[model samples]
Target chain A: MKPAHRKIEAPRVTVDIVIFTIEEAKLKTLLIKRKFDPFKNIWALPGGFVRSKEDIYAAALRELSEESGISGVYLEQLYTFGSPKRDPRGRVITIAYFALASRQKLRIRSASDAKDAGLFSVDDLPRLAFDHKEILEKALERLGNKIQYTNVLWSLLPEYFTLGDIQRVYEIIWGKKADKRNFRKKLLSLGLLKPIGKLRKGLRRRPARLYQFKTKKYVELKRFF
Target chain B: MKPAHRKIEAPRVTVDIVIFTIEEAKLKTLLIKRKFDPFKNIWALPGGFVRSKEDIYAAALRELSEESGISGVYLEQLYTFGSPKRDPRGRVITIAYFALASRQKLRIRSASDAKDAGLFSVDDLPRLAFDHKEILEKALERLGNKIQYTNVLWSLLPEYFTLGDIQRVYEIIWGKKADKRNFRKKLLSLGLLKPIGKLRKGLRRRPARLYQFKTKKYVELKRFF
Candidate 1:
């Protein structure tokens, strides 16, 4: 039975991060293979226990760095999962966060309680440890809804890319294709991107003009799809 | 010194809620005078610690109901504030939540851990206890940003209202007046509101048509200010 509402209880707190990026036109997340027991050898979000004297966000960044050797990504607090039975060890709560990393910043060096780490396409993920699968679903929903009116998707793209490149990123996350003509016209009208006056010349067909966001920082759009 | 990263520690967890409603065309939040020590005689957001076995959301709703006697309002997980020094009693971390209660459904019968309860305008609030002031500020920012692109503002207004009535709610929350012409035109273009086909008849001047949102539930707008 649960304690009375007035009775004070301290549940263990931890931080978990769902680091996301775009690769091969599919959404991918960084997962670390756990090295120790409870769920040994199972892949889970890169995270660890929040230290006694640390902020939750700082804990997320530190764990991401320690477990996967990835840092400085644009991370935001996604949600807090505090189901008392979530952890087998005891009553534990986790502060879940989501991060966006561009492909250029992708690197990994699994260590410190992590047996191995790699990016797995969100479409085909291994059985995750704890309630991480639920956490990933929430992160994906947030990412999908946000990219409609926020510039977060640009964080997964190169600094300069063709219009088609950006549209493909959106489609990959949405898991469906957008009408090419309407998407290009509507996306261009948002004025979120600016032409670089330079074109890509390596393509077999005509060189395509490159464009980049006016500001790389993720911000909400006044109007969007 | 603090224990190593692998050392498991249980930190006290609490749930705090910022209950917001619009009154007199000003954004207001429910505050309760603390009934017990640590912050007694001081007003704080309605909240309490989570029980040994309960979900965080259930804790939030239970706390709100126990103190304010308001329930069935729209509540969402805002953010978690877990700074080690936040609580004076011990190392307590709070999972904060925010709620939207319509003025009609709001009724206060302060009980449980509340000494008194009242509505205070967000623009001019009394000094709050604990880290509640900071939590309220975060809630207000989330509310401000959300209303721009979501139909949440309707939750604070009457079911049948004039176009001007809805615009005033926006202006009040935004803390500034919007261009009437553009606000009305742009708002109508969204096709969110439907005319009730009846006019309000209590005024001395011409009776204006009453309008209600097509749906009362909060929904995201495809395009908004």
Candidate 2:
């Protein structure tokens, strides 16, 4: 017979989100200034501890809303960071999530445990708290790779966008300039975008033809792309 | 000033491993028969609770060793499962991991909390305990997708293997027959395999040349592949 199993202590679990969006033709992420000690007042990913009765996903959504004042946007679990020394407050393991959304949709404000919150370009991030710098780098890498094979880049665009608008989102996330004609050709070949039969308004230059992402086509072609 | 945060209860965390190996040209996974309630006698992935002082990765390795009697193999964190109703023992969340190794190296036995342990082909798995079925399916899908872009499948092969042996591993994981010439052409064109300049000694037919995976080349060519 097996000996009685000993009760094990659980690690304190927290959820951190690296929320990405495209603003001013550049990729930006939301960050919150910590209000408490152990890197207090430094910028970090918006997150908090998981509540006893909440599921992990629910906890992530709650924390995202409380810290950034944004909700209902879908997030993907990027990774779990649990280095023994990652947290000074003793054995806290964090489940990291990444979300992509349109910059105009989020009305972020400092709330709950945060002192301040704002969007910063990925290229011009401040010195982050905890292992948040590492987390953001990993999230960016995931985003770059995901945009190539998935329709996830649509999350960073508005309801109706021109082909140039979509290409700029890709270029910003990928950190490189893409050939405009080739970029449109590749995306159009996938058949995941539908022309809106209208032009994007308010552009200084001639209005470009607008397109909307076809959710059904994107779902069908997800596996192949 | 922000209000002081209330102390929150942490969810009970565990680590579950989907140990995979290629045996008899079939992809097999190691499953342990649960000896305790919740899912008594049900075959499940080898796993256990995380200790207070152990890192998450270390906890995964320790649990894998205790239940399967196998150690030292590298494991990748697959995903975390934390549905509120996943475990009847109240708010238990599990970090799932997947490992690839050769069958001969593993000396698996039913140890620790497991009643019995054995290998089951991926296609013929028994109804697993605690959302393990979903975990295994995800791992298999990851393996299929990874084989195309990463050199991860090399973990399933012996150090010195023939081209045919490598092809068999791919066919087993992908569940499809690949054209021998095209497969060899693609893999060889990558320059990630080095020929040993020796032929199989025991074969009755013409001996095939042996080759070893070139880790350095795989690393350099990782981004493109």
| Best candidate, TM-score | 2
Write the residue-wise lDDT of candidate 2 on A3-116 in tens digits: 233477657788999999888888899999999887899999999888777888888888777766676565889889888678877778899998877877687988777888
- Of the true interface contacts, what fraction does each candidate have? 0.68, 0.65
Note the Cα lDDT for every prediction shown.
Answer: 0.85, 0.81
Prediction 2 global C-alpha lDDT: 0.81
- Model 1 chain B is weakest, by summed lDDT over 10 consecutive residues, at B1-10
lDDT string, candidate 1, B47-147, tens digits:
87888888889999898888667777788899999887787765678999988877887787687778899999998999899899999999999998888
CA deviation > 4 Å runs, candidate 1: A1-7, A158-164, A176-216, B1-6, B35-40, B158-164, B176-216
How far residue A150's Cα lies from its native spot in candidate 2, in Å, is 0.5
The 10-residue segment with the lowest total lDDT in model 2 chain B: B216-225
- lDDT by residue for model 2 (B1-225), tens: 123234776677888998889998789999999998879999999888887778889988887777666665657899988887788767778899988777766778887778899999998989899899999998988877677777877777778999999989988887889899998988899888899899987878889999997672224234322
* Window of ten residues with lowest summed lDDT in model 1 chain A: A1-10
lDDT (C-alpha) at residue B177 in model 1: 85
